[model samples]
Target: MSVIEEERVRGGVFKDINPEDEDQQPTVIESLCMNCYENGSTRLLFTKIPFFKEIIISSFTCPHCNWTNTEIQSAGRIQEQGVLYTLQVKTKEDMNREVVKSDSASTRIPQLDFEIPAFTQKGSLSTIEGLLDRAVAGLEQDQPIRKATDPAVAEKIEEFIERLKKLKKVEEEFTLIIDDPSGNSFIENPSAPQKDTALTVTHYKRTPEHNAVLGIETEEEEDDRKPVNDLDTMRNEVLVFNTNCPECNAPANTNMKLVQIPHFKEVIIMATNCDSCRHRTNEVKSGGATEELGTRITLHLTDPSDMSRDLLKSETCSVLIPELEFELGMAALGGKFTTLEGLLKDIKDLIVSKNPFMCGDSSTADRAGKLELFGQKIDKIIAGEMDVHVILDDPAGNSYLQNVYAPDPDPEMKIEKYTRTFEQNEDLGLNDMKTEGYAEK
Candidate 1:
């Protein structure tokens, strides 16, 4: 076995081993069976799932009582973000789709108002139908005792189990959701390289409660635990801190610095590098307070040389290109401080290469063609071959674009300030904010 495989064995789980090797069989040890209180043999097998991560499967069998139990656990590290998978089951074929539910994941059926809470059951690698079968088995397991004691409750549970069984028939449409704070669960996408229309996967940042449950500390918590001295002296220095790689979940270092733009306000730039995964990412954040009014900047691109202008797109900023009929929403790309050309390239990459459905077998010709054309137009804009107007709308009034004529107003660039609408303020979470008189209330 390789060193990596050996490490896995040391962690109480075996790595992938050749089945033909006589000495490389799965490790088996005597374990106490919970049901029979008898000695049982537990077999541990660690293997990789195709297109997924490593997992450990353990099976315990008590020969005396003929008791058996199987469970799966993810051998991979926790992910940087939580995942929510929504799969629509409309046909019998949908029941055959593969599903991997980690111990930290919760399963829900909206149509039936049923839920399996996290940590309530062991992790399993099964199909949709298999999940429903397990639910029915669990419900039926205690039905006999319940029927003898409480017939009323037993009748309701039996009726529910029948409804669950009916779901396997696909007589009605239903939605299955798997929400995993550890991001270890998965629902197979039947479309493969293409996007599955019936499946919607969303990744979100874990909340503080989730972090507490995971035993992960946030930067804020670290700061409170260890107070830094001389904040003024640290303003100009690059601050380095420990973090985990988002890609591989390995220990990494994040460097942050306060940078001041010559004509604009100060911003905090943070960059992280992972030695294990060789992954690097940098982002910018506005350091100043939100302005009283929103700012809209429009620049007409006429010369190719205009691509070199520096642009700071705040997290609250949206980008619009009227000629290309492209509108990017706020916080879509996070905060970025780069040249105009670089920003446009990033936008093209996001819409084309990074799009989940852009290059799959299920991608329609018309849809793909339009995205390709959109990419080409961006390239033209970057090369100065196309004349168009680019607008930066920031409701927080934090975005900035370089003015070629410093101190003097550029004729091609127009800047406008306007009061933000009530909806915009609400979206920014400013509607409920009480800056003063909070103690009085």
Candidate 2:
């Protein structure tokens, strides 16, 4: 029998399994090391995870090359649909709550402009404060930040780190959002001081790419599966044939996949990395069909939770934030898939980038003063100290402002559908369709 089979049959590796759960035992699977291709050099340890049922913790290490990897996999036949866990962390006690985050989970703290992307680490079992600490450590260890020589940039990073530490200590309040497409992550509800009041858990459907990552294959689907980030998955099964880099005409690799917005329809996000020129570009395309009537959406950001709402803007959508004195025409921004606060920060960055002279360049003294004041107001709005209105106007009516629960409309939001003006039609190159009696010859 192979070593793995022996480990499965004679399970004595975890003799000290928690006394309360004596029946549980760890299984070891020995396989070839990925790094060195040495037989029996990789040992995968499988053990039952506490607090959650039908779940097993899997960790592997290669003695040959010191390679290590860990993952949380389900042992039972039943798998919950994708899930999102949102907790309003108010006090230091709230940060002490236990969290079981899967490797597939992506965490976001909107107010902090912080996100810990999926697959960045093997699953982590930590407290809310510990999670924030991980995010801080990641930022500090990031190559770009560590190697940056600009004093101003370094100062800003330090300030951001201090703010995050404050959040960890619960001196400031922010929403903690964890989205697990695999539905394997959880926040401890049993320890909540009040029944169902500390956190909100919502179940959602898994995307095709998500299911592929978890190896949840359906019998009806094709036997061959592509990687989750493959171009075929990004275009929703429509294969993109182009393989050459657009910038240098060199062979390049592309990864594209569809990601579902919480309160909106799915969007195809495509990214290409060029090895020749080291160029990278990302683009977003809507999954839904266009509408004849132009639509307008207005959202009131009166509460902190509103900042967490997802925003999807088509290329033809115009964005306006009156309080910040910001306006972007349809042609200004190509497209966007970001949260409300993220969108605002993007605009702030655009302003800074476009008007470099206004950032205390001394040559534009008056403009710098005005721009500085404008930037302060935007900062205030993002901090949730100032209430503002966000408006999205789409000539093609393809844009969307996320509702609280998708598919179920948000009655609190104001939406208006209007007839497209002549200019609007011209902008879309539809003026030829309006030439009264024109027909193909």
Best by lDDT: 1
lDDT string, candidate 1, 61-160, tens digits: 9999999999998767787678888999999989988788999889999988999998889999788999999989999999999999999999999989
How many clashes show up in model 1?
A: 0
Cα-based RMSD of the predictions, in order? 7.2, 20.6
lDDT of each: 0.82, 0.68
**RMSD score of candidate 2 (Å):** 20.6
Best by TM-score: 1
TM-score of 2: 0.42
Q: Which residue pairs overlap in candidate 2's backbone?
A: 234-256, 234-257
